[model samples]
Target: MDMEILKVDRLSFRYPEEDRATLDELSFTVKEGEFVVLCGPSGGGKTTLLRHLKRELAPVGTMDGSILYRGLPLAELAPETAAAEIGMVFQNPEAQIVMDTVWHELAFSMENLGLPPAVMRSRLAEICGLFGLEPLLYKPVHELSGGQKQLLNLASVLLLQPRVLLLDEPTSQLDPVAAREFIQLLHRLNEELSMTVIISEHRLEEVFPLADQVLLLSRGALQAAGGPREIVGRLGAGQAPAQLAYLPAASRLFLGLAPQAAAPPPGASPLTVREGKAWLRGLPAAGAGPAAAPHSAATAQPGAAARAGEAALLRCRELTFRYAKDGAEVLKKLTLSLYPGELLAIMGGNGAGKSTLLQLMAGLAKPQRGKVELGRDIHTGYLAQNPLLYFSQDTVAAELAQMAEYAGLSGEEAQREIARLLDIFQLQAVIDNHPHDISGGQQQQTALAMVLLLKPDILLLDEPTKGLDPEAKERFASTLQLLREQGVSIVLVTHDVEFAAEYASRCALLFDGAITAEGSPGDFFGSNYFYTTAVNRMVREWLPQVLTVKEAIQQWPDSGSRS
Candidate 1:
């Protein structure tokens, strides 16, 4: 059997009109039946590399070097052959989905491959069952949520039975519970079928443990390549980029507890909550059963319920919503509020009504039996989950000008505002590029820039951090912090638990169409056993209420707690 399934030999690619190569002298190999994860900061060439796998998906760029599949040059392989052997799921599912309904979308690929009708039918039934997609098979393409569309992309790709699968941030849009199920399905595909999988993703907290190999990229260069242990260990030793600081919560916590004078012992790090928990349990008990954990938001200050009734920038009174008149209720008498100068993070499972709530609050969707009232004199701007929805102008620069013009800014003022926004959002590099031509993360930043230019008093963000890399995400947090200081009210709906734990003034769980729980960052995260941060989960025994690695280090006693 061939050990090397796919090989990239000193591959280099340069986008049209680009000065520097997007991928420069990069080379790596994926082994047969192995699962490989490609990780890096945004615009670090992960997407650029993934696009090179299939001949058709290859971007309109200058290329040097070669990619081989089964020892044959990928470029030399016939398009039909490549289609049959190499399947890909892109970062954006809507771009790849062409059919009108879910059933046709899944079957379209298989039919194009010239598979027998019987075979296609059999496979569709099996896939629909495997994905629990039977009920949604006839749903219109546009009606599916972000997570469902992503699952459909995967299901359609699987229907083709390609020998190798390439997924680019496939789970970025999925909620926690749905994402875990998707990863587990991928694992089953790899183990049971001996399939080869190459995925580039930033959501490492859940997928890190399942990767057979970890490849790190930086500015179109290889930063590190090894098993999870090797790469995470390097991160712990401070040998890698700061972008990796928050990738794995368990590793961050374990490394934080290590004495600063001594190096982290080989293989001493943990990458998941279970391993971190065991490592904590083995530590000679902190004497007291988890030092009186700090008080959480649930226990601190006036109740969030009380605050909801006060002066609110955005308020919902018994809000109820649903997508279709015949569809089940999405929100049932749910009440929430956004106070001035505060950022609230909303968390929930996929299809659990989080997006519906945001849409209702943003006026994109109307409620059936409730009222959504904004405070007097509040200007609202909503940034959709898919940044492309907000783009009317072709280029990022034009987008700013168009939005500014709509807001009645003068020509001279528009340019000044555009320049300021470009720098603030770090979109200067792609300001002149077509919005469609830039990377997903960059598009998101540009969309945010356009929204910020309007200077809306209230902002509603749905998964604003979806495509952002670690550094970009950190900068975003800073931007949000600045907004909070300016008395802007922000309602953020996201799947990023760590970001919420670290930055949200208040975190609320939107379960079963209501705000079941709400509190300050420390208070909200520390109380939840399953939905909380990795640090909170691992260090709970010591500092149960701690929400971040920094807080844990700061709260730990100076000497060994012999108590």
Candidate 2:
């Protein structure tokens, strides 16, 4: 076995304000060349454990365990030694970014370490070449999209030439295509470069197959550890806790097979698209056939569905927008609208005007030409990607209560309203915690809770699932459905195709400052080859039009059904 490069023994930590430990007795080890995937529930202490690996980034908490790097006390290592030995890609790229341009950001770390000018130049050239950063060297960091920023962060870490790399949901802000390439890059780092990698993330479809080992965390404790096949097989086979459970569609389908059906070959639980397709072919008469039809009844086109025979609740006519006065146009003549109770999911590549469009619709920005018109009595609300910006109060309860007071509710009524929203968002446990102290996903939910309290007729959300786990994401989707039923119009901007397909009644694709396509989720997602969901990609031959597992299994009834 390769030498252990990272080790954590009985690691437990807690913030001073908390009576409970955030990480309870966690123990794990990463071999020199292993790609370890760390995943679990949103507030399950994944980030807390990751912080312990880097001494400087460790939180101010009561830590009661040991984290050793290369068999040495991590804290005892010199600052320069630690930076050279370990590189980390933070969850939020913006949090760590300091330099004004890409070139300087890459060199800032080396500059701090006071490397000789020659060494710095050599390392900078090598990293820029490795990550294809030569083209972006002079670009302003603020001008980059979420994906580009994430890539820069990755490249910056690589410039350190650290043997072990740690990433915390590094792709949270990236589009699906960008995310795939990034994970593939990590594979190369592990294979060709012999770099040990540990990533905490929720998107398992792409990452699961690439992970040599899986570590499960739940409620601040380590629950399970093993190879992907061993761990995911158990998860699919119902040997894991429901909260910590996340299975690829094929594995779920495999486990859902009839009790009497023949078992898959030992050690053959498929977790990726290629593996899934091959596994399905093993079933009898599974040949490609006439493509399946829409599993749900046809809905009107997304654009028309949003304004069906009524004055649009919120409408933008010939909207053109840009950030800096002299900057490139973010949106050009982008006319869009939302109707009462309609849910529209807008998707596009990074910096493709999705956020800009949402901002324009929410009345947060003004168009250079044309206008955004809200229907009579239509109060609009907007939620940005970062929930922390929405917080002004110190505690979650105080924040919700303040919003309730603004909504004209009071006393017991306000308390009841607060309790109800807290329970629905699954944030009651952290109700009293400081807003900043909660996990990223929890903060997001708290912010949404505040937005909902506004009781707006139209809502605009940008990348709302930035830090959510599979289970939390499902809950968020359900909440949106409930809001739709309550006659709220929502315009959601996200890179999460699965969530869009599952919940969005209408979907639109924005490319190059224009709405390239708009239609029902079935129409838009079914037609796309690259910007579609995992289930769509997996069963495209037989179920080309089905964009979700529920729809796929419904259309191809014989596929997931037991014999």
Candidate 3:
């Protein structure tokens, strides 16, 4: 049996100003070489708990707990020994990076450890090769795409050869392909190097299958801890807490389609897309649902008929954009139209210029050719990818008030709107806290609330789902649906394929600086392989139209139990 790497015993903590504890008597143990996944709803103390494990970054707060690393108290360990033995990668790639160039960032940590030049060079070469960072070794960190930046951050952390790696939503900003690749790298490290990993994330679709152990938390308390299959069984039996909604698409489909009493016997829950497909094939058909059809690009215009008579709220015709006079074009001859009340999702790889297109549409940046046209008297609001760009006030409440004033609302109207937003975001507890002091997800919610205050007829959001937990994402989707009902058009540029497939009325793929594909969610995601949602990938052979867990449950036989 593997030895215990870290042990937490009856841990509880609270910030200085808060009355209630942020982390309550949490007890858990992680074995060496284990891939542990820690997850829960937003603001549930995941970040706080991770921080406490790393002595240097632990938050200053009232605490009563003991964290032991390899049988030694983490607090009593020497600073250099702790730093070299344990490594942490933050949620925001930009937050943990310190140097200007990729090579410098990798060297910074080793230099502080006073390692010899030969040893540093040897370790750097090994890590760069392992992470495929050799080509980008000399590149300035700012010029790298989100995926590259995140990869570089991970490579930097691994250079020290830490025994245990802790990552806090490390792929929150990466594209789907990149996120999958990152997760695979984590798996490789755990299996080959025997490097223990503790990751806290909301994107459970990919990581759930790779986890050796799963830890679920809620409001700073450990709700469940077990094998991934065991947790899925709990979710199926309705025995798991609500925070366990982070279940992968496969497990979700199995639980939903399987009968209440048929929770799939012990640890037999389907955990992967392939396993899900096999399980689905073995199921008895209820009514012979629609036959799966081969998807083709010809289905691109399926949504055009729905918007036939309505005028586009915003249109970009043959738009071209580039950041510099001699640089390559970011968006070339891109033409798109957004109908009123429609939510259009634009997805692509890390550097495919999705954010640039949103900026051009929002009039924050100009196109070198063609033009962007908006309906007469139309108002537009844009939420930047970086939430910090929109915040000016110290506290979230003050920021919301400032936004309300800017929207020309005052007194009772402003108060009512502010109160509603606070409740919807579940941000009332942190209303008086500084936006920067809160968690990344909370900052994202605060930014979104501020954007809504402007009351624009057209809203442009860039990666609006980043850093959000499952429950928060559901709330955001519902809010988006409500906004659409009120005739507010939205353009979302995101790498979150699942969110786009389920919530966006239409989806478009941007590739090689141009729109390569566009269609309704069913037509677009259903036709995709790697770029589609987990459910679509799982059931594409039997039900090509399914893009979400709910859709799969509805289409497949839900009552029968296969013996």
Maximum-lDDT candidate: 3
Q: Is candidate 1 or 2 superior in lDDT?
A: 1
Off by over 4 Å in 2: 239-245, 258-265, 292-308, 559-563
What TM-score would each prediction reach against the true structure?
0.94, 0.94, 0.95
Residues 1-563 of candidate 3 have per-residue lDDT tens digits of 77998999999999878877889999989999999999998888999999999889998889898999999999999988899889999887878889999999999999999999999999998888888788788888987876678888888888888999999998888999889988998999999999999999999888988999999888889988899998887767764535447888888777777664345588778899998888878777733656679778878656756676878989899999988898889989998889988899999998899888998988999999989999999999999887988878888999999999989997799999999889888999999888877888999999999989889899999988999988899899998998999989999999999899889989989999889888989998887878989888887777888888877776675433421
Local accuracy by lDDT, each model: 0.83, 0.82, 0.87
By TM-score, rank the candidates, best first. Answer: 3, 1, 2
lDDT of 1 by residue, 1-563 (tens): 55898999898888888887889898888889999998887788888898888778889979999898888888888878889789999898778899999999998988887889999999999999999999898999888878899999999988888889999999888877788789999999999998898988888887788888888888788878888877777776773448456358777766666554135666677889899878767655445445756555355334466675568878789988877889888899998888888898999887788888888888888999889998888988899888888888877888888899888889898888888777767887777788988889988899898888888898899999988888888899998888878878899999888889888888888888898888887777777766877778777777878878788766666534321
In order of listing, the candidates' clash counts read 2, 1, 0
Over 4 Å off in model 1, which ranges?
239-243, 260-262, 292-303, 559-563
Name the candidate that leads on TM-score. 3
**What tens digits encode model 2's per-residue C-alpha lDDT throughout 263-364?**
444477777788777876776646645655553223324566555678778877888888889978889898777767889888889879888788778777
Q: Compare candidates 2 and 3 on TM-score and give the better one.
A: 3
